[model samples]
Target: MGEPSAPGTPRGDRLHHPQLTTLVDTARFHAAHSPQVTAVVCEDRALTYARLHRESNRVAHAIRATGAAPGARVAYLGKESEHYYEILFGCAKSETVLVPINWRLTAPEVSHILQDSGSDLLFLEDEFGPVLDRLPTAPPKTVVRLAEGTGPAAWTAGHPDTDPALSPTPDTPVAQLYTSGTTGLPKGVVLAHRSFFAVRDALAGAGLDWIDWRAGDIALVGIPGFHVGGLWWATQNFNAGVTVASMRAFAPREAIDLIRDKGVTTACVVPAMLRMMLGEPGVEPDDFTTLRKIVYGGSPISEALLEESLALFGSEFAQIYGLTETGNTAVCLPPADHIPGHPRMKAAGHPYPGIGSKVIDGEGKELPTGAVGEICLATPAHMVEYWALPGKTAETLVDGWIHTGDAGYVDDDGYVFIQDRIKDAILVAGENVYPAEIENALERHPGVAEAVIVGAPDERWGEKVHAFVVPVAGREPSPRDLHRFLVDRLAAFKLPAAYEFIAHVPRNPSGKILRRALRDRFWNDADRKVN
Candidate 1:
C-alpha cells in the first residue's frame, strides 16, 4: 500500500489549549474565555458558554442522581435543540456515554437500539411521546420528557450548577452512535473523547486549511446531531469557541433564512441539502451572502450541481468523505481542487494529518498504487468497538485499521477515489461494474437530475445493470438518449441495460442513497440475492 505524505508535527494555537483534551475540558475552557458569548442557538432558545457550562453541570448531577454509572449509556430521542447540547456535555462531564438516536426511526427500530445499548435512562422529546406507546417492549428505567418548562431545565433545577470535577481520560468512551443497519441490525459504534479532537491536534500547524475555524464565525449545523457528522461538526466549533446556530430540523427555506438572518459564515452540509437549498423558490445569491465556506459530503456530488451551487452561493466549497466509524472525516477535497471540471473534484481528497489510508486486495494483502480494492483507514479517531458485538468488531477493526467496506484506490498524488461499496459492485459476466461511475456520468446529462444503478438477475449474464433515473423538471430524456450520452464515456458492461425514469430518489436522513431498498425489489423472490 502506498503511504500518503506524512503529517506535520503538532503545534499549539491561541484557540486550542494543550491541557484541554476532553470535551469537558473544552466546555470549561470556553466558558472561562468566552463566558458571555452565545455557544449554541437552536430555534428561539439560546445558551451562552457560561450558562451552558452551568446547566450542563446541573445535568451531570441529575444524571448521577439517577445512579447511571460511568460508561453507562444514556440515549436521547429528539430533534436538535439547546437541551440536546446540555445533555451531550452533561454525559461527558458525568463520565457517561451519550447515544443520540435518530428521531426518524420507527418504534421497533428505536426499541432495538435502546434495548441493545442497554440504556439506563432516556431523554425523549414530547413531540415523540406516542413512540413510547408503539414500542415493542418496555422503555428505559428512567425517561425524562423534554417539553415547555419541564425537560432538562426542571430536572436539573435542584442540582448545584458547578462542575462535577469528574476526571475522564482522553480514551474514555463518551459517545455511542449506531451504524445505519444497511446490512443487518445496527451496531453501536463507541467513540472516546480523543476521537473528537485528534485530527485538530494533529493538524494544528500542518498549514493545510482544508477545513478551518475562526473567532466570531457563526456556523450552521444543518445536519441533525444524531448523525456523527452533525455531532462532530458541532463539537469542533464549540472547541474553537464560536457561536453555533443549529436548526430544529433541516428545511430548505428555513436554512436559507437562517443564513441570511444570522450571517452564517460557515456550514457543514450534505450535497442533498445544498441541492434542495438551491432549488428552493426565490433563492438568490444574496440569500447566502454571509456564507464564506461550505464543507459538504455524505455522497458524491454531480459536476452540474457543484457548479450551480458555486455560482449561486459564491462560496469556497470543500468536500469531505468519511464514515461514522472514522469519526466523521478522514479525507477532504480542498477548496483549490473544487474547480468545476477538475479531475481531482471526483477524488475523495488526501487524508487529514495523522490519518493512515491504504487499499487492500480480497486476500488481505495491500494493493499497489492506483489499484482498485477495499480502502482501509487507521486513525486516532477510530472507534473503540461495536458495543456488545465482539465478532462484528473483530471483523471490522483488524489490527487498529478500520476495514472500510468502500472500494477505492490511491493515485500517485495520494488522492483517494471511491468507486462504490464493495457489496454494491455488480458482477456482469465475471466483470466488476461500479454504480458510482455510471451514476456520475448519467447525472452529467442535462435532462437527468439523478440516477441510481442496481444489479438485477439475468438469465444469460449472471447480473445486468438496471438504473432508476430522476429526470430534470420539464425534461424527460428517453432511455436511448441516456444510452447515447453515456456510450462514449463508459465501457459496454458498465452501461445500464434498462432504465426506469422516476420523480425522485429515496434517500436516508443523512442523504445517503438507499441502494438496498431499490436493489432488493429485483431479487425478492430469487433463490439467492447474488447473481
Candidate 2:
C-alpha cells in the first residue's frame, strides 16, 4: 500500500516519461487524451481507449468484489483476446498483481506458478478447463471463466464503470511473469510499474525511430502476452496511444496477412518466425510494404538468416538483447548497423540510453574490452527481485547489476558479441566449443534450411559436437560433404562429429532452441540434462 508516485514526479533516471507511470495509467491517460482511438484489435473486436478504460473500471470493481485487495495476486490463463486488456488493466487499477500464465505449459508447470504466486482468483477461458482438470490439485483460489456476455464479462456488467483511483506507486508490484524454466524450475520475475515506464523514458530519450511510437502506427502482437517481449511491445504502443493488432496465436502466414491487412508499421518477432514468413507462399516484395521496422531477439540471429531477412522483408531491423529479469531490451542494436556484412552487425548493439553494461569476470571485476566475460547490465527496468527467492536474487542481482548468464564480450567499439550460454558451452578436451558457431556455419550452407548444435556425452573427448540439421526441401547432402564445407570455415575439432537430419529444430515458445530437449534424446539415462 504505497502512495502513488508523488503526483507527476519522475523516478529512476532524470528523464521523465510523461505518458504513464503505473500499469493502469495507459487506460487512464489514453481515455482522456484520445478516447475514440482504437487501442487493441483481437479478431473482429476492437476496443477503443475510452471503452477500454471504462470497462476496466467495472472489471476492477468486480475483482474487488472477490475479496482480493491491493497486493493480491490474480492469475489469467488463456489466449490473447481483446478482453485480455480488461483483465490486465483492471488488475492494475485494482492495485493487484496480474500473473499471466503461459498456455503452452503443462498442468504441473502452470500449477507450480499459481501456487508460487499465491493467486487469490483465477480467470481462465472455457477452453482451458481441460487443463485445469489435468492438474493434480486445483488452484487454491476462486476460479472464474472469461468469455463474452458470460462469466467475467457478465459478472462485471453489474458493476459501475468508474475509476477506483487506487494509489499504487511506480515501485508497486504490478505484474509477475514466470520464467520458461529451461535449466530449472520457473521463478516468478516480479515487475514494478517502473519496470515498463523506465524503458519508455529511455526509448524517448534516445530519440530512435525504430521505437518512436506514434499514433496511427499499428503494432502486430505476435508474441504471447506471458513473455516480457509481448507485454513490453503492447505497453509501448499503449504508452503512445497507438493501435495494436493482435494475433491470437503466431502463425507465420497469419502474422504476415495481419501486418499487410492492418498496415502494421512495426513488429517484434524472432528469427525463426522471420524465416517461416519468408518461406510462406504468396510472399512478394510489396507484401510487407507497410512494415517499416522489425525488432527481433530471444535468440541470436544467424548471419545467413539476417541476410535473407533483409532481402525478404525490406524493413529496417533492430536487434534486442536482454532477459525477463531486465524487463526487456536493455541493449539495442539499432537499425543503422543492420548492414548485411558490417562487423558490428554480428554484435549486440550498445546499451540503451540511461542503461549501463559492462563485461564482468568470474570474480565480479570488470573485464577489459575484447575479453570474454559475463555481460552485466544495470538498467532502470530491472525486475524488483525473484519472487520469494531472495538467495537466487542475491546471486543474480549483485549490487546494482544483473549478471547475465550469457558469455560475451564488449569490444573496443562498445559492441557486445554474445558467444553462447555459459552453462551450455561445451568443453572438448579443454577446448571450448560454442554451439552457435557451429550452428551458424551449418545454416550458411545453401542446402541446410536450419541447424542446431549441441554437446553429446563422450568418454574420450569429454563431450563431442553434435548437429541436428533440417535440410532444404528436395535437397540432401551427405554428412561428409557438410563436414568438408565446415572444414574450411571452422576448426577441425569444431566440426560436428555426429549429424542428424530432422524436419525441424524444436524451440520454446520464446523461439529459443530447446537444446536440452535435443540433448535429452541421446542421454536419456543421464542424471543431469547438461553434458
Candidate 3:
C-alpha cells in the first residue's frame, strides 16, 4: 500500500476515511457524502446513492428473515442490472458471500454451481425460470424471484429500509467469481472486500493516472457482472463516487448508442466486444466522442485490430492482463504504450504500485530476465482460496503469490511479455509452437478479422497446428494465400498444417477463445483422449 498523506490534509482526510475499508463502508460513505448522486443506472431504472443504501438495507433484512446466517452463501443468477448491484450490496451488508453465476450456462452447469457452493438462498431473474425447473434436484433452501419492476419481491419491500448495522472487516469474503472452465471444471475464486479497493488505495496521491476516476465520469459496464472484470470496474467507479451505466446484456449497437446518449467518459471491455462494436453498420468516430479512455483485456489482441480500434474510437486505450484469481488485473499496458507499431505495444505493462510479479521455472527457481516461465504475482487483491478445494488452492497460491500458469518473460525494463498458457503449447517433431504467436501473425493479414490456433493429434508427430480464421467483411483469403503470406515469417515447423475458415470463433462470456472446443473435434475423431 502507498504511504498515507499527512493528517488534517485534504488528501489525507479523503484517503483515510474510517468508513472506507469494506463494501458496507463504501455504500455508507457515498450515501452520506452525495445522497442525490445517481449511483447506478441500468435500462430504465436508476438508483441514487441514498436509494441504493436504503434498498440494500431492506434486502439485508429480508435475507436474515429467511434464516440465512452470516457468512452463508447467497447466489444470484441474472444479467447485469441495477437489481444485481442492489443484491450485491445487500449481501455485503448482511455479511454473506455473493456468488454471481454466469447466466449463459446450461441447466447442468447452473445446478453444479448451486450445489457446489452450498448456497443458503438464491435470487434469480424470471427470464431463467426454465433453467430452474430443469434442475435435477430441489433448489436452494430459499429461492426468491426477481422481476423488472417487482424488485426481489413484495415481501422485501415490506422490510425496514434501515442499515443492518453489521460490521465486516476488509478481509471478510464478499464475492466468489467462478473461472471460465475452458480447461476443466470451474473453480470458485473467493475475493474479499479488500480486493476491490487495493488498486485505489495504491494510487492515493501517487500522481499517477494509469487508471483514474474523476467526478462527472459516467462509466459503461458493458461486461457482465459475473465476470470479475466487470464487477471490479463497477465497484471501483462506485468507490470513487461516480455514476455507472450498466447494460442488462451487451449488445454492440446498443452499447455504441449508450456511449453517445449517456455521455459515458470511461468504459471497460474485451477485445472481442471491441471488434463487434466496430463491425456494426454506420458507426462513426463521432459516436464515441464522450469516451476519454477504454480499458481492454481478457485475451491477447492483434496489433492490426488494436490500431483499427484506436483510430475509430479516438480514445486512449489501456490493455489489462490477469486472471480471475488475481482480482482481474495485476498488469496494465497504459495508454502511453499504445503506439501502433512500437515494440512495447506487444508487452504487458508494469505491475501496479503495490503488486509483485516474477517468472519461475518448474523447479520453483526464479528465472533470468527474458526467460519464459510460469508467471507468478503477489498482490493484496489475491483470492482467499478455491472453494472446497484445499489441495488445488495450495497448488496455486504459494507463499502469498499466485502461480498464474501462464508462460511469460519479463524484460529489463520490467515489461511482461506473455507467450501463452504453458499447457497450450503445441509440439511438432520436438519443436514447440505457441498458438498465440501464430494467431497474431495471421491476424496481421489485411483479410483476416480474427484467428485462433489449436493443436490436433497426429500419427506422424505428437501434434499439429490447425488454424481457424474469420475473414474480414467482403474479403476471403484462401489457405494458399495465407501460407504464402506466412512462409517468410514463421519457420516451417511452426506453420499451421490445416486451415478452416469460419464466420466467427467461439468465446466464453469473458471473451476468451475456446481453444478446447476447436481442438476437441480432431481428438474425438482420432480417438486421442485429452483433458
- Top candidate when judged by TM-score against the true structure: 1
Error of 1 at 459 (Å): 29
Model 2 agreement with the true structure over 1-531: per-residue lDDT tens digits: 001111111233222337578868778888998899998887777889998899889989998998997989999998887778788889899999999987766676678888889997998888888778877666657888776423367768789999988868889988999863333366889988888888667655555453566547888887688878888888878877888887777888888888878789889876667877888988876778989888877655666788888887888888887878898888778777777777887676777667777887888888877888888888878999999999889988988788778788877656677764555655453344567667777888989999888888764444688999999998877799799888755646567988999998898899988888887776678533333
- Candidate ranking (TM-score, best to worst): 1, 3, 2
Please provide, for model 3 over 32-120, each residue's C-alpha lDDT reduced to its tens digit, 9 standing for 90 to 100: 99999999987777889999999899999999888888888999998888888889999999999999987876665678789988997
Pairs of residues clashing in candidate 1: none
TM-score of each: 0.80, 0.78, 0.79
Q: List the residue pairs that clash in candidate 3.
A: none
Q: lDDT per residue, candidate 1, 82-155, as tens digits?
A: 78999999999999999999787667668889999999799999998888778888999999989943458877
Comparing 2 and 3 on TM-score, the stronger one: 3
Would you list the C-alpha lDDT of every candidate in the order shown?
0.83, 0.77, 0.81
Displacement of residue 25 (Cα, Å) in model 3 is 0.8
Off by over 4 Å in 2: 1-19, 148-151, 425-531
Ten-residue segment with the worst summed lDDT in candidate 1?
A: 6-15
